[model samples]
Target: MTDNSTTTSSVDLNESRAPLLGAVAGLGAVLGVIAVALRFYTRVVIVGKVFHSDYCILAALVSVVAFTICNGIGIGYGFGRHGAAVTPEEITAQLKTTIGVIFFYHLSHLLIKSSILLQYIRICVLPVEKRICYVVLALVIAEGFTWIVVLFLTCIPFSAMWDPGLPGAKCIDNTAGFYACAATIISADVAILVIPPFLLRHSSIPWYQKLLLGMVLALGGAATIASIFRIRVIYMATKGTDPAWDAAPNGLLALIEVDLGLICSCVATLMPLFRRWHPGIWPRRLRHRGGNRLETVSDLNCVCSESKSTASEDRGGKTDVGDAVGSGTKLGPEQ
Candidate 1:
């Protein structure tokens, strides 16, 4: 007989899905759709018919959709229910769904990191910034492929991961391995985020504008935080036996993390669209304010030149404001 704890944790397969499982899965789908829509609008309408980053975002959207589909299927198979309540078939399906989820998780983030890096490379004019982006891109590509390979190879003969009763089937420590992958993914996330901020630091843009950009770029870190939560859930679920019941949160967190990454990837590129839509928004305001600062400097220079010119004319028409007296010289940024 199953223990009381098993009964308490497991859900009935015939019943509605667990709230956490359903809510997260549904929210992920909704957010992923919105993200992709915004991405399409930005790339098509504002960005002039797509770019490399747009392709990456589209690929990430596809992966997140696949991830969401897996979550939905798992939900029907007692994903959030207690292990004691799930049939053998339901649990098996859940395990299979798990393989798909892990694969898509790696795939989605791979696309996201690619999108972010591509966007950076497109805009970064400095050689140092381009070099930093290249290094980060290499890191992202290496880590993403590593995790993808690990997820697929974590089980030998593969089918053995979900079914321990198969002949000659063997599986590695899934929870620990996944945690390692998640941690490394988060590390990669930190690296990607750090690259942009460091590049922004060297930019001539105002410090406040850089700060805003940093915050926008850091949105990808939300995925990292979600991965942290997933790691904790994985650690706890590994110590337990309720696969159907315990794996729900892990599944939900996986969808959430991936979808959030996709959404944030689009968000980082949508500032132009946002500025066109909402002129008073922070991005536009930042640009406007920066322009005003430049205008102020130009005005001051003009005033200084006029004062010197008036004084020069007073002193026998001797002028020091060469080519800067009446012409409004737009000052170039200080190197």
Candidate 2:
């Protein structure tokens, strides 16, 4: 017979990743809130107006905050300990929180991608550019809806997801579903990243300004990288028997991916604030009329409108490759 003392000692020695998960989740939440707040200040107070994309991002921030809270709740229920070390009640509680995490995680990504695509539609000048954004936006929405349905229907009677001991409990192949979701999300990320360069190439802005904009837009790549790592962790977790212990890394990565997306999206819109504080940071030629006006990629609608008007006048109502775009208007000047 196994010694009771030895068994108790072994259980006590089991590794727990709760602290690490808690720290990462807490830090990510703090940074995400700050980023979104700054973005709103720049758009509403500094720019004097807000757009649909801004509201979408605000919703995304709410979803991410919810996602973070679910993670925190899970941690309190012994989410980061080995399955064998945790009581069955703790496991049930964590599993219930897992459903919440999945819901908020998907919601966060849907809103974030929608925000980016809406921003693209506002900025793009060409018919083809707007069409592409619409197509991508539709795809994101459809995928999000389909997955949400799958999430709820994965178990014949949803409660079976958390309490597998239910009478005749059943669940779909979770591993397959997760893999498919990850693949589609990563694909959408790559598509979003590619659209900016295409829009910039056709813009009338100077090459230096294009380069500056490219750097800011490239921040989205970091979120894609996080997605990649998160998927790898998911793969490993699927192959492991200790789901609770394995879940720590997967949850940490998921939080990072959503938070990174929020932070990066908000940072792109903060150019006006940056320019107000540091006029000299922009190229000399870009400073219009003694820096009273300055155009930025973030002001997509204004820029595209200005481009169309300039093109009409320059080409005498005729369009050409060289006259496709024109200099855009100032985003806004600091008072």
Q: Supply the global lDDT for candidate 2.
A: 0.73
Could you tell me which 10 consecutive residues in candidate 1 have the lowest summed lDDT?
319-328
Candidate 1 accuracy as TM-score: 0.80
- What is the per-residue lDDT of model 2 for residues 34-135, given as tens digits with 9 covering 90 to 100? 998988887777766778888998999999999999999999999888777779999999999999999999999999989878876765657777899899
After superposing candidate 2, which stretches have Cα over 4 Å from the reference? 1-14, 206-208, 284-335
TM-score of each: 0.80, 0.82
Q: Per-residue lDDT for 110 in model 2? A: 92
lDDT to native, each model: 0.65, 0.73
Model 1: per-residue Cα lDDT over 1-335, one tens digit each:
22222444344544444777778778877887887788677667654556777778788888888887877787777777776676889888988887887788788888888888877676553566678888888888888888888877877888887787888887788767867887888888888767656645543345665576667766766687888888777765565566666566677777778878887776766765665666545421112353652212212122223233333233431111111111112112111
How much is 57 displaced in model 1, in angstroms?
0.5
